[model samples]
Target: MTILVEKPVLALEPKDVSNKDDSEKEMAAKNGFFAPEINSFGNSFRDYNAESARQSTVEEFYRLQHINQTYNFVKRMRAEYAKLNRMEMGIWECCELLNEVVDDSDPDLDEPQIMHLLQTAEAIRKDYPDEDWLHLTALIHDLGKVLLLPQFGGLPQWAVVGDTFPLGCAFDDSIVHNKVAKQNGTTLPPAALFIIRFHSFYPLHTAGAYKHLLNDEDAKSLNWLHIFNKYDLYSKSKDKIDIEKVKPYYMSLIEKYFPAKLKW
Candidate 1:
């Protein structure tokens, strides 16, 4: 009897990734070309180490995303994750889980996963107070990245993390025009990324589909996206930002959108 060969982590098919259970999904999720979030947890990197350097020419990422991410794909994914059935948990655990995405490949400062998240949130909370949701938004925007962990949701890097864009249509060049979405072959899914970029409320405003996704909450919170975007991407500095110095401020923001402790 003849059998078919299935591709492994380095060359996974979308269907292959989707079929996995939490354990198998976790295994596949840590493929590590950049930093896969699917199988990660609180202590994955406690015994820290260094990583290598690699990047892509900006040209390739746009080419495929522009072609593959049609409007239909966006609608389909939004419909799927919006069910919230994939993982109905609390926000704090989700946030903690997202830290696995600290791309060791960058060969830069080895910031722990949680510190990067705090940097973005604290940076915004400093400047924007009236928009309470904006502070919470910064905290949770990357929570979808937790999907890379089996404990949370165990989705692939493409499904739950990375530079999110509008999936139902063409890829935008402005998001992040190099390396990852190029050599890695996928980016965040339309649903989580779309929700992070938008929330279904009022809006600060951007071009194309960005303006349309806001609900009252989304509109209220999106301002932080603008604030966090700078530090989240560019602020991966050589020095680690101190998390203790900043937690109380974010604790206040957490109290605003979520309860004192999250369920997940």
Candidate 2:
């Protein structure tokens, strides 16, 4: 499919990034984005070892996830959800459905799934206003979490959301872009698809794992994913987005990139 996207009004010039610890904050500031110093829990972002009430719950969830997310198990999940036989709904409808879900593995966010989606998208939109495709990509990236709903088999939290990584010989799982949007015939660019598919892959993007596995295309996609990941990780707060106000804007993007109704 030929995906149409907006041309950036100003091409970002590459900068010689300093190895200083505050590089990320400096970069965000340069790009007209602000990176908060702490997360909603008054802890640093993605600090899994932080002492908090949610710490034990997050650790336990990871324990279960590591144990059960085996190669064979992921294969089964891929085949099962590839069917996309769950139901037909538009992007907005799926977003509404996700409001009932939350990610137990996310130490930074305990908000409903929809809030994170909007938070991430709005943050990106503010910083990169010309990138409409990116805004929509952020919005729908976690729609696959609907698998946790009863109508979609009510999958366990461990299986549905977390920092995704490979268990098999190669990387493949029932991620949003891999199993949902691509299967449903989305015309989003490869970069948008990459962000949708691997935004939770903290080890690769954040910890610098699996760098050797990246090809030329994966390398290019990783740059965009890196930019997207910051907002996805840090935008989680008690702040509320006015859904009714932003609905029309995202709906227009949805109509541009996706069919009115999709199979699950």
Candidate lDDT scores, in order, read: 0.44, 0.80
Cα lDDT of model 1 by residue, 107-137, tens digit: 2324555766665565544444444454555
Per-residue lDDT for 254 in model 2?
Answer: 94
Candidate 1: how many backbone clashes? Answer: 18
Candidate 2 per-residue C-alpha lDDT over 1-264 given as tens digits, one digit per residue, 9 for 90 to 100 = 865655333234322222335767677667655767698889998777789767988888877887777889888998999999988989999999888997888888889999989999998887778778889999999988998899998989888988788775554443212221167877678888888888888768877777787899988888888888878887889999999999999999998888899997
Q: Looking at candidate 1, what is the lDDT of residue 219?
A: 46
Residue 120 miss distance in model 1 (angstroms): 1.3
In candidate 1, stretches whose alpha carbon ends up further than 4 angstroms from where it belongs are 1-52, 56-76, 86-88, 103-112, 128-133, 167-195, 198-228, 260-264
Off by over 4 Å in 2: 1-32, 169-181
Give the RMSD in angstroms, all C-alphas superposed, for model 1. 18.7
What lDDT score goes with residue 224 in model 1?
A: 35
When summed lDDT is taken over every stretch of 10 residues in candidate 1, the lowest stretch is 7-16
